[model samples]
Target: MKTSGLDVAPVNLTHGPACATCNGPTRLTGIEPHPMRPRTDLQTFQCLVCDGVQTAVVSLVH
Candidate 1:
């Protein structure tokens, strides 16, 4: 979709996880608190090269 005119390219995720589709870099797009877990979050990411989206669960218990 729409960005703030800021480029998402060159913004790689920490540890540099590759996109499953294009094997390109991904950037974190969004994060939200998990409904069922107070110490967890749902993270959304988008591939910079292919524009593919991915979601993941992150725990905040550390």
Candidate 2:
């Protein structure tokens, strides 16, 4: 599905500790607002291993 130029798809992530700095798996915290879609926020995840962060823009369609 799609909405307002945002594509709705399964947001999956695969990550692991690349080094000793990173401990374990990553975790999702909250959503962030997009520049175009002020009402929408993208899903954000943080890596436990390397403290790396990732964001996935998702469309909330009802």
Q: How do all models score by TM-score?
A: 0.68, 0.49
Worst 10 residues of 2 by lDDT: 12-21
In TM-score terms, candidate 2 sits at 0.49
For the record, the alpha-carbon RMSD of candidate 1 to the native fold, in angstroms, is 8.6
Residue pairs clashing in model 1 are none
- C-alpha lDDT of all candidate models, in order: 0.77, 0.62
lDDT of 2: 0.62
TM accuracy, model 1? 0.68
**Candidate 2 local lDDT, 1-62, one digit each (tens):** 64687565654455422323455676666666777985567877787666777676766655
Which residue pairs in candidate 2 have backbone atoms (N, alpha carbon, C) closer than 3 angstroms, thus clashing?
22-49, 23-49
* For every candidate, C-alpha RMSD to the true structure in Å: 8.6, 7.3
Per-residue lDDT, model 1, residue 4, is 94
lDDT of 2 at 46: 80
Predicted structure with the largest lDDT when compared to the true one = 1
Candidate 2: residue 4 Cα off by (Å)? 23
Error of 2 at 30 (Å): 2.2
